[model samples]
Target chain A: MAVDNASITEVVLGGTRGGPDVKTLREDKWWKLPLVTVLGLSAFVVYATWAAVWGDSNFFYLPHNIISPFYSPCLAHACKAAGDTGSPVFDWWRLSPALIILVFPLGFRMTCYYYRKAYYRSFWRAPVACAVQDARPGYTGETRAPLIIQNIHRYFFYAGLVFNVLLTIDAVQGFIWPTLHHQLVHGQYVTQSGGFGMSVGSLVLCVNATLLWIYSLSCHACRHLCGGQIRSFSKHPIRHKLWKFVTPLNARHMTFAWCSLFFVAFTDLYVRLVASGTITDFKIF
Target chain B: MADVTMRIWRGDDKGGQLVDYRIEGNEGEVVLDVIHRLQATQAPDLACRWNCKAGKCGSCSAEINGMPRLMCMTRMDQLPAGPVTVTPMRTFPIIKDLVTDVSFNFEMAKRVPAFNPPPAPEGGYRMAQVDVERGQEFRKCIECFLCQNVCHVIRDHEDNKAHYAGPRFFIRYAELEMHPLDTNDRRELVRERMGLGLCNITKCCTEVCPEHIKITDNAIIPLKERAVDAHYDPVAWLGRKITGRKKRSADEAAALRP
Candidate 1:
């Protein structure tokens, strides 16, 4: 067989497989995922302390900001009825706390290439993940439990990405809206953001979303799924350019996985800070 | 010299039992050397398969002391202080003692189509170094059948044999798909018909691979993604519609005439 040594080098071990730039992140505290996770949780302690001294917030600036344009009744006319009458009531403090915890899995889910890789590598090999010799016969059957959840990563990715976009939009709303005081206005103690927590929350959310987006979009499986078009894409000028943007993210999909993981932790921190009131609801937008 | 105990499975499809033998060992002795000693003196009829016991050819796929290990590479001292065990691969049928019917692997190999190269350009073929690098992971496959033995698709669903082609074949499929000089439309074949959908991406094959090939990340999952793109991506379908005609014409001209 006239095995081309060039082909051997190129075909077997080429492309993103040999990128030499893994020096910075792979060797850091991140690889100690346990420590990152512990510290990530520990950040919550700081958040809790900050919240207890201050007070929880409900950052809703511009109380009349349109939440659901589609549901509003003023769309039929010139629509000049906006005076804080129809905006949906929301609790930014309560929501931020809930969102903090919810965002971790979302970020992990968004950028998780390892889930699929591990699923196929670890789960597929079954009871024989390791081989035995001269001992009792090994079972060659499918393994069960949490391992089986590997199949739905695609769907999970979709959910996390969508939630990221939605949360970013929420962050945007927080930026544009105004904060509230314990307005004895209607005497119901109706709390809302007249000018407080929304701006910082929105900024935090944007950074959080952008990082998570990079991590999720840079995923290895996503790259492969799209890379199928690499050959045909080479000829098309437009797709070729688009794929270039995706290439770096796709190349270091694992890096994105770790980056987005920490971002999610940071996102939860931001959400907790906003909700718990450790950081004053300056609503600085 | 030190004494080491071994439990060897000795039997056929009809019946089977573990037979023990004690052997003297020295430091730095390889498992293959110990097995050779056992075969030379005591159990002459013992059947085992090996070639290039240096770990290059990948022929010595066997489980050692209940762990899938290459007998050629495993050292006796690395094992726990007790009787070591040896057996044939589990996914494949037992052919005899310490040897299973691995012909299923070759049979699967036979099912894979021969590689077909794309048409040469008028000036000749060209490919980038960066483009061809990732395929090296696929090409290094030693055909140890360790991947096949470790695959849950084969181990869990023996009935999967009818529908599935297992991990090694996926490596083959991924290699061809990623080949810079090759031309084939095996992605849809691998995905829909070859049971690429069945691989949940556990990474057991990659973990056990002595070559350290990232079988799951570099090969199988990429192949699966190709399949998904081929089958589902509208843009890919469009690209194929645009380019498929030219490639098919070129392939027909260069490939063997039917």
Candidate 2:
């Protein structure tokens, strides 16, 4: 049967109608996804805010020198010497150390391809699921001001790489515990010594760094960086190989995104507990 | 004799429900074949839209067992031992038993600017093998609207239909923008009017694509990158301001020479 071209044109040109005719009739567990996303993102936001502002217990185990991921590269001059090993590059601001660097990582997550879908559905109700109707009257899309910033995700990916390097350095520092060996050299006595050993804190930081690396590498931006620009995959054998390798990870970008998010928070919490003497760091030789 | 139960949707715009029909199955039958059988033996007036019984035409797209698939491509034997449910694409307004009003897609197509290539050179315009291949991947689109139906931007959000152009046209825009000999600049139109940013790269469109087009990675994301480079990049933004607006390159002008 031939499709009525005239009718199709009439309907096509007919301007925006109201909402959908049917809301949804899906009987199987539709609410679960949005509920989990809302609760998960809300918890992360709350915890991150509290942790950033609490200030005192962010740096723990001064003698052992295991710094929290949140306060790493602590730039405030007022920060205690234990976590301030990176030195205060900008001493003007004495606020929460996380405030300065948190934007980079947070921007990375907020603008992430997967997370955008997660939050858009959960929070914005931009069609919560496959057959569900949206609550909004009109769809403005990302063409306008704030939403358009999402396009800058590739730039955030670049900034995220810098953070990954700094975090990896923190993880390496976890393995080197301070020893009690102080001697006067010139006019100064070195209060701490360093040796290679593993602590539970070190393991936590290591796992955090590893998960983050996987998450960042599996990013859509990174996948695009690897091969999206190439016109033909056959000519550039190396880029083709890299794109193929990243494809599987890119397929599971959502899994890595969530796992890395949970692990980052867990790592921060572990350091905070150890710093506050709430938990003991088990050392492993 | 092996038999299969087909629960086809029977409804219209106001409301509808599933109606079951039991039919005898053959060795290598597809869902469309079964539907055809049902039309022959059981229900004569049972309405559904289809042209080519093959998958190439993309006219027989429907949700088979709750997943978007071409009815002609979905094999009966591949389905599990249960009643196979067939329904019209959920994104559009149901017109009858299994047909949807897909005019929303045509409207979006109309809204996009037509491919405006520069005037041809003396003989004809020359295109490199690589440049042609880049646009070729997108040209394979059959306008199945499966990508449009599956996209949550317009699928779930009914209002989004006005602003968003869905995946089908994103590839169209990508095809025109990526063409080497084409001189029109659609980055601004793509970003502003076409609502390119509405897509968050969920890859839902890619998953449901019958042609296996890389809707998210190749077309959508690259188009997004171009939009960002033209509109957002600090360096590009500075260059645009300093250089004023860009005219067609000398090579592009030469290609258009009569």
Candidate 3:
């Protein structure tokens, strides 16, 4: 039997299933998608790396009480240098607060089901596009060491939920500004707490928080947690309801993943610009 | 109409090679139409499998220009200029010409446990539109096996075929798993026997889906997450222990195995 499995074996495995040596017989612009994926992901990674390490320590806009999503739950003592009051528990650690806080959210995004597809195709070039030969041949996938660690994605999802809560707190705090009026009544100057207000920065923070919440909630792990293990949805009404609410969001997880990623970076840039006096914090009220 | 050269694979189990055939193909014609013209005029012995000549039948699946597409669906004009190369699906052993033995898929299909729904209520099985719609997306699959052909697990390594059910059956499992009324506990089945763990989810299956199903996002990832919940989740394990709503025991799971 002279089975002609040669064409695919040649393309996929670089084997002599019986075809000519060719990168791909596909003549279309198949590379365009992988190229765009590389550019887009690389841009975000570069911007995020810059914002994390090299940004002017102005991640917190004091006037508007808006903290960058990158710097939210800012726990490091170095945050005080950035004019943001962080917990004394972490006062010992001296480095970028963004670095400490980013690991959880970064882990969440890195192990994300959608992101796995993006990076595997764009970065690893594992069959870069459908029917396209992979850059390298040996394939073990997530079943083995290193890649098997991706099974901890749900734990990261838990950590992401905690971060989402902290960021939501930061967004709520964005609404409470320090009143400009200073009082000397008690032999000490005091700025009254401005009760409730809104600003462009606050709105930005709110949107960032909302998007992050949606992204986290729309996670496949989240959807699974809600209703996956159960044999019957009718038996678990509460979990079923939660699953129902999340199912639609889960469908658009990819959209939220990109939109939230871009907005988080944009929110940081907005805070940086305002804190650096490059742009004024526009008050909507 | 213009004369177009098609470099198609011509061989049986023994061996074959790409043989070119110049035939008159119309601008509006599809690749299948071109093949039909070639079969009628040039070579009557040319073996090709097709039914309905429509994309819906999924019978005319082959690798056209290194991409798995239905011959009925690929328009001649859409192909790039020069000789078009058509080959049999590489995942399966070739029977003759463009036809390959797809019995592996059928064998895998038979291994899947039938949908085991719970006894219907007095009013019958009622499901929300959203719940039904979730499974509906998976049902759109025409079983063209493009996803199976493109999947790296079985494509690159034929040895994985025994354990791995490929993407087509994964969606089948997902559809059954997500069925609101299904009572079959398939968590162990998916992980152990069906080879869900082997899937790295590169999404080649999702990309090649002719029906545009979100195979990776809607089906595979969710199934992976479900498997995670079953075996890996610490919190879920704790809850199951406390509530005494234990997962299927190892003995129970083994009994259900083929």
Rank the models by DockQ, top first.
Answer: 3, 2, 1
lDDT per residue (tens digit) for residues B1-258 in model 3: 679999998887677888999888887999999899899999899889999887888899898998888999999988888999998887788778898878778777766666666678798888866577668889999999989988877776666777788899999888987887766667767787678888878888887788999888778888888877778778778988999886664334334323
lDDT of 1 at B39: 93
**Local distance difference test values of all predictions, in order:** 0.56, 0.75, 0.80
In candidate 2, residue B186 scores what lDDT? Answer: 72
Candidate 2 per-residue lDDT, tens place, A216-268, comes to 99888887778654545556668867877887898788899999989888888
Better of 2 and 3 by TM-score: 3
Which has the higher lDDT value, candidate number 1 or candidate number 2?
2
- Give candidate 3's error at residue B241 in angstroms: 2.3
Candidate 1 per-residue C-alpha lDDT over A151-268 given as tens digits, one digit per residue, 9 for 90 to 100:
3455556666666676556556645554556643222344674543445556665676677678767766555444544554434446545555776776677566656555644654
Label model 3 with its docking quality class.
acceptable
Sorting all predicted structures by lDDT, with the top scorer first, yields: 3, 2, 1
Candidate 2 CAPRI-style tier: incorrect
Interface RMS for model 1: 14.4
What is the alpha-carbon lDDT of model 1 when measured against the actual structure?
0.56
